[model samples]
Target: MKLLSRIDIRQLRILSSLLQERNLSRVADQLGVTQQAVSDQLKKLRETLDDRLFIRTSNGVIPTPYAESLQPKVEHILAALEDLLTPQTFDPRTVTRTLTLCSTDLEQIVILPKLLKILRREAPGVRLAVKKLELDQLSTSLLTGEVDLVISNPDFAPPSYPSLSLYPEHYACVASKANKTVRKQMTVEQIAQIPQVVVSPSRGDFSGAANSWFEQQGHPRNVVLSVPTFSAAKACIAESDICGFIPARLLPDARLRVIELDADVPGFEVIAVWHNRSSQDPLHQWLREQLLAVATTP
Candidate 1:
C-alpha cells in the first residue's frame, strides 16, 4: 500500500507515455513538460517501483522487462481513472433500464397510453413496469428505490413526499345509454337519487370524492356499488343502469352517454410525486415533463 501511496497519477502518465514513445524527449513533448521534468518524474517512479523501468540508450531509451510487463496494466488503470472522473449523462434514446411507476388504474388508463406512445418513440429501449398504488406500502417502496414515480390526484398522492402538478382533472356525470331513469337533463337532486357507483381504488368502502361534492350541495348520491379502479367502474356503469363521475379525459365513449347536469361538477388536480432523493434525477425529471405534456395535450 505504501508503495502505491508514493506513486501518483502524474508519474503513472509519464510512465505510460514513456512506455509508448520509448523516448524521454517524446514523452516530455507529449505531456507538455520538459525532458528534465520527465527525468525527475521517472526518477520518482523508479524509486517507488524499485526498478529502473527503462535503460538509457544512445538513440533514446529501451523498456526493461519490468516496464514492458506493466504496459497493459498501466493503460488499464489510466483508462479506469479517466472514466471514473467523467460525469454521468442521461440519454433517453439509449436508455435500457426499466422504470417502475406506481399509480391508480385511473391514471394507468387515462394518462399512461399517451405517455407510453412518447416513450416508445423517444426512448425505445426504456421499459416500464406499472404497479397499482398501495397506500400502506407506498412510502417504503419510494424511499427504498423500488418505485420510481407516482401519478395520482391530490387525495391519493402521498402526503410526505413532494409532488409536481401535472394538470387539473374534471369529472362528468355519465350513465349507460340504456339507462331509462335519466331525463333529458337532470338536477343534481334527480341525478343523486339514481343508482351510483363510486370508485375508491385503495379502499373497500362504497365511498368516493363525488360523495363529498354531492353532500356539500345537500343532495347526497345514492351509492349502490363500489369499484377499485376507473376502468372497472367504467365497465360496470356501461352495462348497468348506474351513473358515476368519470374523468373528463375518458369521455365520449359510445357505451356510455354523458348526462347533462344542472349543477357544476367538481375537479381535482393531478400530480407526479417522488422522494426527495429523486428530485434532481434526470430520468424522473424527464418522466414528469412527459406526463405534464401528455396531460396538457389536446
Candidate 2:
C-alpha cells in the first residue's frame, strides 16, 4: 500500500485548520468537531507524514518545520476542493466567507462605505478584505487566488481577465475654499498658471491624465506638488495655494471648492476585473452585481 493512501484528505484539512487556528479546540469549533476528533486526525496525519506536525505551546500549538512546509499545498488543495463542492445557488445571508478584493484607498473611500452598509444589512455573514491594487501584480494576484476582484482603471486591467465597466472616472479642479486665485470659472490659460497638485498613483511622478490632456491642448500644468491619492491631493489643495484635478465624485469637500475649468480633460473607464475561473461563479457574479449597483448609484 502507498504511504500516502493511508491518509484521508480530511486529515490534511485538520492540519490546514491547525495552521490557521493554532489551537486544537478552536479548530474543532471551526470545523464543527470535537478536540479529541481533531487529535485523532492529527495522529493519523502525523503517522502518514512520519513527522510531528505540531508542537504544544503555552498559547496553543505551533507548526513544526515539516507542517509549515505542507501548509501552502494543503491550503491550495482545500480551496480547490471547496470550490468544486460549492453549491450553484448562493445565499448571502447564510454563507460565511470573506471575499478578497483589490482597490486603492481612494476607491475604498468612495465605494466601500456604501457597499459595506448594504452588506451589513443584507449579507451580515459575509466579510470583505480589500487590499491595495498594484497594477503590475494584479494579473498574477487574480490568477493565483491572492485577490478575487480588482476595482481599477480599465487600462490597468490585464486583458486575460474579464472585466465590467463600473463608471467613468471624471475629474474636476479643486482648490482651497479661501483661495483668491480661483473663481467660479477659470479660463484654460488662467487654469494653467496656478500651481497644480498632481495625483500620481505611484506617488513620485507629477504626471497624470490631466497633465497629458494639458500638454495635448498646448498648455502644460505648473505642477508644484505630487501626491499618491485623490484624498491627499484634495487635502493638499484645501490647505495651500495649489489646485488639483480630482474625481468628480470626490466633490463637495468642506474645505475645498470645485472650479469649473474651460479645458476639457478626458475621463477613463473604471472597471471591475476578475479572473476567468471566477467569471461563471455565482458568488463572484453576485459580488460583481453588488459592486455595479453601488458604483452606479448617484
- The TM-score of candidate 1 is 0.69
What C-alpha root-mean-square deviation, in Å, does candidate 1 show against the real structure? 16.7
Which residue pairs overlap in candidate 1's backbone?
A: none
As a TM-score, model 2 comes out at 0.71
Which one is best on lDDT? 1
lDDT of 2 by residue, 58-155 (tens): 99999999888886677666667777888878787886779898887767988899899988987898899988768778887886567999998876
Task: Provide the lDDT at 29 for model 2.
Answer: 93
Candidate 1's residue-wise lDDT over 1-298, tens digit each? 8888898999999998888778999889999999999999999998888899999999899999999899767866776676576457878897777889988887887789999999999999888999988767777677556798888877776798889998888999998888888866889999989999988767768878888889998998899998878888888999998899999887788888898898889999888888766666667778888998998888
